[model samples]
Target: MIADTFLIVTLLAAATVRGAAPLVLAALGGLFAERSGVVDIGLEGKMLTAAFAAAATAAVTGSVWIGLVAGIAASVLFALLHGFACVTHQGNQVVSGMALNITVSGLTVVLGYAWFQEGGQTPLLAPGARFGPIELPGAAALASLPVIGPIYREVISGHNLLVYVAAAAVPIVAWLVYRTRFGLRLRAVGESPGAVDTAGVSVSATRYMALVGSGILCGLSGAYLSTAHHASFIRDMSAGKGYLALAALIFGQWRPLPTLGACLLFAFADAVQLRLQGTPLPFVGVVPVQLIQAIPYILTVALLAGVVGRAVAPRAIGVPYVKER
Candidate 1:
């Protein structure tokens, strides 16, 4: 019984890490964009586009690397368009973002039907075409250790390459946002564009840089969704993950460490919900999976609804920069 309990706990923890991977990456993408004064509501659309691009490219070439590149390119292109609309043209950020979401939602389906003729899914990729999990060195040998062994193996290892990249990005982003000159300018621009402009820092340039990073990360998140987490793309497969990521960004107070923690909590709740599917509790008597699935959203809503604290967004966010003639 002890062994079984340990096994279940270990599995859930591993699954939580796995599930949090995309959220962390996507939330990071949104965080950077927002920090630079561009509210990126189009993350869902960009992710969906990248997922389709990756899956289709991989299917054609049977090369995951090429697919990844294609995915990033697609997402970057979309990000640029969002930048053009919200930053250059000074359009409504939320509307422009939702437009992209609607556009991709329809476009992917139309394209999918044309390409595959069997609904909005790409061809199922072979395991070789997917980003398989890596087994860390010394993990097998360390599995014999009592507590540390299982924790390390389950939580610290067994994820695909992108998971580690997302984890490592936390510290890198923290340093970039807090310790670097460009980071200081970026944060300042988000808070006070007028001050940054007076300092001779191009607000457009800084925000554009943020969008670039945002696109790359979102691309990774999308590609990982279709290629690593699953074998192919399905219509709307992003499934509002982008919004959940945004929620995490707000709930985390737009900080990297707190965002990471939020992602983990959301992922943990999701993992537990999945594990509880069709399982009966003493008084509950076999709760429905749909109800279980709602837990994360409910928690996020509670957080956003002032159960935590006022969500302090960047002051200059969603505002376009116009220079004096």
Candidate 2:
């Protein structure tokens, strides 16, 4: 009985890492665009479109890699749409992003049915077509260790390659945003596009590139959702995770490492809820399922409302640049 309890605790801790992957990845992508002076409210749409594309492509080609590529392409297309609207037509950024979200939510369902005839979802794939765990060196042996080590080895260590990529992306993006020439121009444009424009960097081009980069990361996150997490696609599966990611980014002050930590906290809350559902705890009796589900969101609201100070945004964010004659 003691062994079983110990194992359960380890598994739950590992689940926290798995759950954090998507949120961390998506939030990092959002940090990229927003820090560079563009607001990508369409992250939900980008994720949804990528999920559907990945599932459908994987089903057809019997290769998860093809599906991943397709997912990135789909996200890039939608990102471009947002870019065109905000950059060329000078449309409202919030409105444009919301429109994309609604569009993908409906369009994917409609088109999914047209192609698959399965009520808006694609057929499941065979073995070797979907993403599987990577057997890291000594992972299985490490899982036998006591306490936290087992969970880290078994649950967190064997995720798809994308999870590692997502984990690495935070630092890479953080460095790009804070330490590079491109990063400087990106922030400059977001803060004062007039200055960046005067310096001969095309404001529109920088914004467009940022949006496209955001789309690619979002696409990778979405692919991990459908292919790595569940091995299937469902309409509206993103389920406002994108918004939660945005909140995390803001909560972390738009920094990558802190934002990833915030995402993990949210994910850990969710993982703990799931782990506790069937377990018999000592002090806390079986809590209401609804209450458990609300923990992460409650934390998010409380943090935003009570603790976090006012976050600073880019000066030129959401505003189109017009050069003076």
For 1-325, candidate 2 gives per-residue lDDT tens digits of: 9989787767776777788888887888787678767787888888899999998999899999999999999998998999899887788889998999999999989988999998888887776777888888877676666665566676767878888888889889988988998888888888889888888999889888888888999999889888878677888989988887887887776778888888888787778777667666679777776687676666667666765565567777778777778
Tens digits of per-residue lDDT for model 1 on 129-168?
8899898998899999998898888888888988998888
Q: Model-by-model lDDT, in order? A: 0.89, 0.83
Q: What is the number of residue pairs that collide in model 1?
A: 0
Q: Which stretches of candidate 2 lie over 4 Å from their true place?
A: 1-5, 143-149, 278-286
Residue 84 error, candidate 2, Å: 0.4
RMSD of each: 1.6, 2.2
Model 1: residue 57 alpha-carbon error in angstroms? 0.9
User: Considering every candidate listed, which one attains the maximal lDDT?
Assistant: 1
